[model samples]
Target: MPDERTHARAQIRGVKETAEADLLAKKNVIGVDIADKVTDGKNTGQLSIVVFVEDKQPTSKLSAADRVPKEIDGVPTDVQQMTVELQGPSMQLVDDVTPQVDTTTYAVLHGGISMGPLRSVYLTPPDVTSAGYYIFAGTLGAMVRDRGNGATMALTNFHVACVNSTWSVGDRMVQPSLLDGGSSSNQFGSLTRATLSDDVDGSVVTVDTGRSTTPSVQDIGDVAGHTAATVGAAVRKRGRTTELTYGTVISTDFTVTINYGSDVGSRTLHHQIRVQTDTSRSARFSDHGDSGSVVMDNNRMVVGLLFAGSSDGQWTFANPIQSVLDELNVDLMVAPVVTRPIVSCLNTRLVVCNITRPVACLFTRSAGCNLTRTASCLVTRAVACNVTRATWCPVVTRTAVTCSVFTRAGCDIPIPDPGPIEGGQSEDGHGYGATADVPEEYWAGYLAALEEINELDGPDEA
Candidate 1:
C-alpha cells in the first residue's frame, strides 16, 4: 500500500534511513500501575492528573521512622492524598519538577512508596510533559461500538477517544485555545457513544447511543486515497498534542512492548515507518496540546493514532491503524474494503474469549477457538483456517468468557475449546472494565472519594 507522495523524505535522509529495524524485545521496567482515561469534552485540552494515593505523599518533610499512617481531625492521611496541578493558559510547557507539597499535618502519619518528582508525573500536559505511564503507550488503537450489535463500531486510538480513561461514546470532543486556564474554547469535536474496550485483563464492552451524525474520519491530511509503502515508508502524526511529529516507519510489522499494569506485554504491530522531523507540514512531532491527533500519509489518509512520545520526541508510535481495524471488525484501506473473513471456531479451530456466556450474550467473542478438536465441537463443516499467524482476540460487549470453539466458521454459538486458553480473565491486551459485573461495594468508596474530590475541586467545570 505504499503511496507515492509519502515516499521517504528526510532532513538527514542519508544517515538513519538505512538502519535496520531494532526491536526493544523486552519491556524496560520493574513494575508500575497505570490507569486508562478520564474525560469532559472541551477543546481547551485540559487533563486531570490521577495520582495514586501512594504518589501523593508529601516527600518534602519525612520523619526518619515510618509514622503510623492515619489522618487526624479533617486532614487526609498522606496515603489518601494526591496533588492536582494544571497547565497554565496558552498551553505553556511547565518544566519545573512538580512540587510534591506537604498536605499532611503533624497530626497525620505519612509516607509509603517514594516516587521521584521526575519520572512518574506529567509535570505538564502532553505539550510539555508526560508521566510515561499513559494508556495508549501500550494497547493498539481502540474501537467504540454499540452495546447491542457488534456491527456499528468506530475506531480511533484510545488516546483520541479517551482522556484519562473516561470515555463515553457519543460524547463530543474539542480543542480550544485558552485566554486563561480552565476555560472551554470554542473548538469542539462530537464523539458518538460506543462501547469501550475492557481494561488490561478484560474484553471490550459495547456502548450504544441513539445519536446520529458521527463524524466521518479525515486522515491527518486526508491520506486515505494515497498509496501505502511496504516497509520503509515515512509517516507523520498530526494530533491534539505535539501537533505534528515526524518519524520513519521502523518496521512494516514487528512486536511492540507494552506495559499494562502488572505484566510486560508484546503485541504484533505494524507501522508505515517514520522518524521525527523538525517540521511536519508545519506542526511539531507532538506538542502538549495534542492527544487524539491522527497520523496520516502524503495523500492524507490516516495510518496511525498519535498517542505517546518522549520529550525530545525521538520515538513515537501509533496503534497501527491496520491492526485495530481488523480486531474491531472494521474496514481499513477504503477502496478495496478488504476484510479478513471472520474465523469460525469449528472443528480444528482454537478460540479465546475474555469471559463466558451463553449464545445470547453480547460483545464476548469466542476467541483462540479451535473448532474440530476443541472440547466443545465435532464440527460438521470444514473451513480453511490459518494457525501460522498468532490471531488477535475478538472484541465483544460486556460478556466475560474464555475462548471456546463452535461447530463452524462464523458460527455465533459457543462450542467448547479444542485447546482452552489458561485463564478466563484476559486473552488479549485490550482491557475490559465490566462495571456491570463489578460489585458496587468495591468502588463505592472510590465513588464517595470522588464526591469529596468534586466538592474540593468545586465540581469539574465543563
Candidate 2:
C-alpha cells in the first residue's frame, strides 16, 4: 500500500468527506435493551440511541442518547452534526479482505492494471456455486502452453487459482478494474489445470480481497519508454496501489509456508513471500490491491509478477518468470537465454537438482561426479547445501532456501478432496509408477540429463 503520508492522508481526507456526507444519515428508534436482563446497573431494561457518520472514523457525534435521533446523517448534514460520530466505520471487515492501500499508489495501479494499455487476464478458481465466477485481478509473469494440444493457459500462483479445492475443469477467470476503465476488460477466460503447487497458510475462514490482488506503492523515476531490465539485473515495478519500487532477487528458492490447510483450514496457498529490496523503494513496494501487477525488468521483459511484498521493502522475493514458464510450460522469451547453474553433490558426486529450473529438477547420479549446481542455496547453522535432496523439503519462497528431502509422503501433504460432484485428486509423486506421472516432454529432458550424468552404458561391442 502507499505511505500513510500520501495515500492514507488522502484517504483520511476522503473518508472524512464521505462521513460528512452521511453525517445526517442518523435514525433512532424507541428501543429497549432486550438483553438477558444483565446488569450494567443503570439501564438494564432500556437502551440509549446514537448518531453517527458512516466512514472510516468510529466515534459518532451522538452517544447512546436517552432520546431518539432527529436526522438522517449525510453530506448535507452540518460539520458539527457530522462530528456526531458513532461506532461502525472502523469496525471489522465485511467482505473479502480489507485493502490496505496508500491512496496515491492505489491511484497509480488503479490506473494501470485496472486500465493498462492491454488489459491482462488472470485465471483463478471459480466459485462453482456462483456458476464458476472468476477471481478477478491475478498476476502472471508467463502463461502456459498445453502439451496435449498446444493450447495457451494462464500461469499464476497456485493460491491465486484456488488450488487444493475441487474446481470444475475449464472454469472461468476475470480481470480487475484499473485506471479510468471500470469493468473495462470484463471478458472471461477458461482454464484447465496445467500445473498446481501451493503451500499452507494459517486458518482464516475466507480469503480477503487483499489476499487476492490488493495494492502497494513504487516510485520508478520514469525510465524512458519503459525500456526493461533482466536477471542478475536490477529492475523497477510501478504498482497501482504502490508508486515505484526496486528489488534484487536475493533468492528464488521459492518455498512458501502454510499453517491452515495441512489440517484445519484444509486448503493450501494461504501464505506470504519474503522479499529483498533497496531502501529507496524499500519503504513500500506493493500491497493488498496491487496483487496482479506485472513486474517489469529494466528491459521490461516482465521478469516477475508483483503479487505480494512487504510494507517496508527490505527483502523481497518473486516467482521467477522461468518458473512460471515451467509451471504452465510456456514461452514469453523475447530476449536471448542465458545458461543457468548445474547442481551436483560434492560428497556423493551425484548430479544434484535445480528446484526452479522449469526443467528437470533431480538428475540421476554420475559415478565419481563431485560437483553440483542449484540456483537456490542456503547456509544454515549447517553448510549451504543442495535443496532438493535434503532430508526436509525446504519451502521455496516462504521459508527461503532451506534443505528439502524427497519422500512420497513429504510432498503429498493432504488437501481436502473435492466435494462429491467435483471428483478429482491431486497428484502424489510416488515410486516407479509415479515416474509415469512425468510428462513425456518433461521426462525426455530428465532422461537426457540423467544419461549425461550417469554415463549410461551405450550399445557397445556389438
Best by lDDT: 2
Task: Assess each prediction's global lDDT (C-alpha) against the native.
Answer: 0.31, 0.33
RMSD in angstroms, all models? 31.8, 27.7
Expressed as tens digits, the lDDT of each residue in 250-339 for candidate 2 is 332223222212212322221222345656645655553444344555655555544444333443434455444545545442323458
RMSD score of candidate 2 (Å): 27.7
* Poorest stretch of ten by lDDT in candidate 1: 109-118
Which lDDT tens digits does candidate 1 get at residues 1-462? Answer: 234312322211222222112112211211111111123322222111111222333444544333323322222211212221111011222332221211111111011100010111132333335433321111112233433454433334443334323445445322122211112231123444322232111112222244222222322322243233334456665432333345565433222223221121222222322334445444445543333344565555555544444334444444455444444444432333457756454534322222222122123345664443222111111111222212343333433334342345656655433332222222333212222333435435533543454455342211
Task: Give model 2's clash tally.
Answer: 90
